[model samples]
Structure formats: structure tokens, C-alpha cells
Target: MTIEQMKRNARDKIINEIAFLAGGLTSACQVRAIICAYLYVDLVSDAEYREYCDLILQVENKRISQSDF
Candidate 1:
């Protein structure tokens, strides 16, 4: 698979796993913090990065249900 495709797969898995973490709410917040920092010095294009970031935000904000994953 292409690198972008691989990244998407990893992103999906990470986000989903974080959503269901032992203490999901706390984990989600921690992940969101990392995403914010990782945005800099990262190779992903803004659009790709946004997709991943959006998922975390949606989960933390309760805009999307973790069960939806």
C-alpha cells in the first residue's frame, strides 16, 4: 500500500483505540494534546492531518459517539 494509505490506516486504528482506552475520556484528551503538538514537524498535508485531528475532536466533544467506530 502507499504511504498515505498506510498513514490513514494507522490513524484510524490509533484514534479508535484511544477512544476505547481504559479511561477513554482522559486518554482522548491526552491524544488530542499530542495531535496538536505533532501537527508541527509532521509530513502529513494539512488536509490529511485535519481528518485525523477532527476524529479526536469529535470524540472528545461528544459530537460523534465512540461506539460508532
Candidate 2:
């Protein structure tokens, strides 16, 4: 997939898992770490991986409140 697509996929995956992620501690860090690690391997270079990480972090930090549910 393209870099933008990859970024979007990562963001979506994180958002989807956020609700079931368990106490916002384990999954927030663990899943993001796993995804970023995988992106590091899958991307062409560190730069792309870094961008993916940034994008993923932004997604992970998005505010979701009880009312949104």
C-alpha cells in the first residue's frame, strides 16, 4: 500500500482497537508499538516509518468521550 494508505490503515486500526484496548494503558502503548514496529519493517526507510509513527500517534491521541459512543 501507499504511504498515505498505510498511514490511514494504521490510524483506523488504532481507533477501532481503542475501545477494546483495556484501560487505555496496555493497548494504547502495546498495539501502537506493534504497529509502528511493523511499519518500520514494512516501509522503505526510517523516514517513512517515522511519518507513519507520527500519524499513528495523532490518531491514537484523538479524543473520544462517552457521549460519542
Candidate 3:
């Protein structure tokens, strides 16, 4: 695969795993925290980084359901 495709695949795999592990309310919060820690660096593009941050925010804020993943 191309470099960009590989990056997307990696991102998708991590996100999907996080979403899967967030099956309950408590686990959902934990997932948010884990994702925050995992993304502590500022290497990726602003928009790409914000997408994941926003997703966790929605989960933490109960604006979206974990099953939506």
C-alpha cells in the first residue's frame, strides 16, 4: 500500500479498536482518556488530529453512542 493508505489503515485500526473497547459507559470514558494519551503528540495535520479528538469528545460528552462506531 501507499504511505498515505498505510497511515489511514493504521489510524482506522486504532480507532476501531478503541471504539470496540468502549462498549460501556465506564469503558467509554477510559477509551477517551487512552486516545488522548495516545495522541499527546502534535505530529499529524491539524484536521486529522482534530477528527480523533472530536470523536472522543463526543463520547465523553455523551453526544454520540459507542455503538455508532
How many residue pairs collide in each prediction? 0, 0, 0
Model 2 per-residue lDDT tens digits across residues 1-69 = 787787667666655654445335444566657666656656334665566456555545563353266
Where model 3 places Cα greater than 4 Å from the true spot, the runs are 25-43, 63-69
- Give the TM-score ranking, best first: 3, 1, 2
Per-residue lDDT of candidate 3, residues 1-69 (tens digit): 776775666577557755664444345556555455445643345576578667766655563454467
The worst-scoring run of ten residues by lDDT in candidate 2 lies at 18-27
> Model 2, 36: alpha-carbon shift in Å?
4.4
Which portions of model 2 miss their true places by more than 4 Å?
A: 22-29, 35-69
Cα lDDT for residue 42, candidate 3 = 32
User: lDDT for each of the candidates?
Assistant: 0.60, 0.57, 0.58
Error of 3 at 55 (Å): 0.8
Clashes of 2: 0
Q: Please identify which of the two predictions, 2 or 3, would achieve the higher TM-score against the true structure.
A: 3
Candidate whose TM-score is highest: 3
Candidate achieving the largest lDDT? 1
Task: Sort the predicted structures by lDDT, highest score first.
Answer: 1, 3, 2
Put down candidate 1 lDDT per residue, 2-52, tens digits, no spaces: 767756665665666566643464576666555555456353457756786
What are the runs in model 1 whose C-alpha is more than 4 Å off? 1-13, 20-27, 61-69
Q: Report the candidate with higher lDDT, 1 versus 2.
A: 1
